[model samples]
Target: MMDAALQALKQYFGYDRFRTGQDQIISRILNGQDTVGIMPTGGGKSLCYQIPALLFPGVTLVISPLISLMKDQVDALKDVGIQATFINSSLTFSETNERLSAAAQGIYKLVYIAPERLEVSGFVRILEHMHVSLVAIDEAHCISQWGHDFRPSYRAIPAMIDRFARRPAVVALTATATPRVTTDIRKLFGIEAEGVVATGFARDNLNFQVVRGQSADVFLLDYLRKNRDQPGIVYAATRKEVDRLYARLTQQGLAVGRYHAGLSEKERAASQEQFLYDDLTVLVATNAFGMGINKSNVRFVIHYNMPRNIEAYYQEAGRAGRDGEKSDCILLFAPQDIRLQKFFIDQSDMDETLKQAEYHKLEQMIGYCHTETCLQAYILRYFGERNPSGCGHCGNCLDTREKTDVTVNAQKVLSCVKRLRERYGKIMVAKVLAGASEQKLRSLHLDRLPTYGIMKEQTQKQIGEFIDFLTAEQYLVQQGGAYPVLALAERSLPVLKGEARVLKKGHIRAERLAVDDALFEVLKQVRKTLAQKEFVPPYIIFSDQSLREMSARLPATDHDFLMIKGVGQQKLEKYGHAFMQAIAGYQAEQKNAVN
Candidate 1:
């Protein structure tokens, strides 16, 4: 069965073999056992079922909530020369009837349908004559109310499963689902899926970056200029932002388009067509846009603001680097951005308690962002899966200096929060810690606390970083609404009680202090030397940014410098001589042999 599945993988998906968790999921499906796949986004969740859909004896009914995703999957299957058709609102009555008749006649191997379509009176009757080998539910997370992106319509799928006379094995796939949500999916589907494949949620191919203190305009423009001609998607939190970004990009001579729920179907389809064909280089869109895009060449995925949940972030970010190329996942963050989301949550129709719960969920997402450890690792750990080793590929790992034990700082910050009884948001707490004699601090009487100015030696940025560090470590999560509040996580009981040591520096990089002044002077020389050798601008050869990174890494060989990102062939070759000169000069001056 494994051999056959592997053959299908190569024959259709054009891969030599399955990715990390794909084979195991396919194996279980082929053995006729129910399975739940909790793979991360960009983790190849489709092949787990698609390969099995081919390996099985009869037709596979794929239940996909996103009509656009259904259409894309069916299109991909057809492109690979497999027999497939999807029944959705986009189909004409005649077209829909034709596909259903073909499924009745067993002409298609995979039949796609939205749950609403499947639950229609005559739809199951049409399916009754077909050979139903397996039931695969994509975006299976929607079956639960508590899921981050829930669709009440998905609850109708189990009825279709029971409608079939000869039972087909149930298979579920989702990029995001907590262990609790996973169990809910199993129980709701009437499947006892145990030890189901939940691949470690880590993408070593992506360099994860969460940049704070940057305005959206600055971040987007600088990022786009740095990576011109590359395919990427920029997700905005609102329709207004999308429109503004699209207009700005267009004015700057970029091929750009805007997508949102307000657009007409024809407009949406046209924008999507333009994007997929590479007629447009960038998509400034809201969250509703990516379900249909299966473009594998997207080199970057940037969020103009925070996503409401980790699941949504994973799904959007997963769209990049599908071809297994090196890619970037950048999140442009601001402290008030969370407050905007909190305001949205508070103004919703939900009652006070449920509204409060949703607000907390957003805060958890913010903490996830500031995490010093591997973003992928933190996400996977949150979903109740564990990796024995760090990913060693994400931003936290590849950053210039590994974060050091700031836990002591975090404890002090948390102490301040506790001392204030979770009354203040990050700003007020920051003021208190910096021992600000400002009028606001005096008014709040926060200056009187013994812990106030306890960390006076640290800069405000350092102290803010420590507090953000606590958010990342999850000892403290933003809480309440309006003014915004801070509260302890479920795991924070012991931390708050001082019984458990809070882990700091959620980063994977080993700590390396900044270079000594002598080394800095030598690096400056290296930059000047490289600038003269390369006929181009020195900044083009090696931006102060790139040089700073190299100085911190101290690459000993040409190969190491080449491996330093942004050292493309052009820069590497043109400036290689000067870089070599710098290394030689340093070695001679110090009388040390080259390592």
Candidate 2:
């Protein structure tokens, strides 16, 4: 079974070897063990089930959360000549029935279904007639209440599995899962000891940053202008922000698209299609975007606001650098983002316990934003994993921070908060310190305080940022309510008494991660043309990583081309000639120039 799975991997999926955790998960599944794979994004979780689906004698059932996700995976599978189909709300009743009929007739080697379909009697009855050798659950974290995106429909999966005549081997997969979530999935799936597989969550190719105290619009425009040619996503907190950023970027002459729930379905689809086709270099979206996106060449993912939790941010930011190239994952944070997230938590349907849990998670995200430690290590630790002492690739680890002693400045802010009796939020505090003549300040008689205007030289943004840093460092605490108040934490005493020094990272220009290679550009054009001709995503044809390898190696023969990482037997046969021709032409030109 292992050998056959490997053969299928080469022939169908176009890979030379299994990625970390895939081989173990696949082997465990092939041995008929209930398995749980907790892999990070870009960890090739699909191939674990896909390889076994080919090796299994009966059809493999894949339970996915989104139609777009199923369609993307099934389309990629069918492109490699695998028989795969998905049944979901996107299909008409007749179309769904026909596909179910095909599945029963053994027309598809794998069938993808949304978890909600498990509760449908008709869907279950149809599945009962088919031989399902394995059940693969994508986004399996949804089954646990502790998970970031819990779905009640996912809970029905166990009952659906019991309805099968012969219980198929179960394999649950998720990109982000805490130890609790991992245990929940295992218990839910009846996976036994040693049945869990996981890879490190740290993505070395990704450089993480938290860009606070900057104008999000100005900073975004500057970053985009510098990295204009790169494909990226800008994630905002709300649809209004998405639209606002979209309009601004569009007016600025950047090739940008927008995605959010407020947009018409057709508009969202069109925007997603444009981004997938490389027609749009920047996609400004809310958290609603990127759940099912499989685009591999995204060079950056910038969060306009910090997400409510680390899980969501990691998954969203993981969308970038999927091709194993260096990419930026930046969060343009503000203290108000905490309030925004709290507002969302308050509006949620979850009970008080769950809401409190969510708030705790939000606090963790806040900690991440305020942490001076390695960003990657902090994230890894959040996910219940560990990494080396220093990543050296993140904003903090880059050591480019211009540290300034803000001890005196910090005392003034803390003292100001105390003098006001901690009755206000960051903006008001910043304003009071900056001596902004606001009517509210006059009404409150805040200008009478001796601490007022002590830091008048600092801008509002700078003062707000100092408060955020203090809040993060526990020198100040932001109360959570309808209107948040600022209060001093126990740690504030040291700064107030001059017993401890306070330092903050000054503005450091982020290092641009663009690799300029003429040959790479030429190969990309060839890939684009081929993808257009074939009517597939360019990354599906060849990832940026593959193209870079091709450009570097300048493979002249089919055998040499096959040596490239992403080139499998089927892709080599389908695309070997054109790539070889391009490489040969470039090599000849270089030789001629040298002569």
* lDDT of the candidates, in the order given: 0.73, 0.88
Give the per-residue lDDT of model 2 (tens digit) for 417-524.
998888888898999999988888889898888877888888998888678777756788778676789999998887888799988766656555697898898888
Using TM-score as the measure, the top candidate is 2
In candidate 2, the residue pairs with backbone N, CA or C atoms under 3 Å apart (3 or more residues apart, or in different chains) clash, namely: none
Candidate 1 per-residue lDDT over residues 1-595, each given as its tens digit: 8988866665554356677888788888888888888886667887777888887777899888777777666765654568998998888999999998888777888988887776576877777778899999998988986677778778878887888889898899987788778889988987776746888767777777787533457657767876666668999999988888888988887778889988898998888867765567788899898876566667788898898777778778888776555778888775556767867786677777767667777767887777777777777776777564567877667666434554466667777888898888877788788887898888878899977988888777667666665664556777766677776567667665667765433333211112345654566566655445532223334433455556567666767766654454444555555665676676677775543
Could you tell me every candidate's TM-score relative to the true structure?
Answer: 0.68, 0.92
| TM-score, cand. 2 vs. native | 0.92
Those runs of model 2 whose alpha carbons end farther than 4 Å from true positions after fitting are 386-389, 415-489, 591-595
Q: What is the alpha-carbon lDDT for the whole of candidate 2? A: 0.88
Worst 10 residues of 1 by lDDT: 506-515
Give the per-residue Cα lDDT of candidate 1 at 90. Answer: 83
The positional error of residue 418 in candidate 1, measured at the CA in angstroms, is: 20
The regions of model 1 sitting more than 4 angstroms off are: 193-195, 350-356, 387-389, 401-595
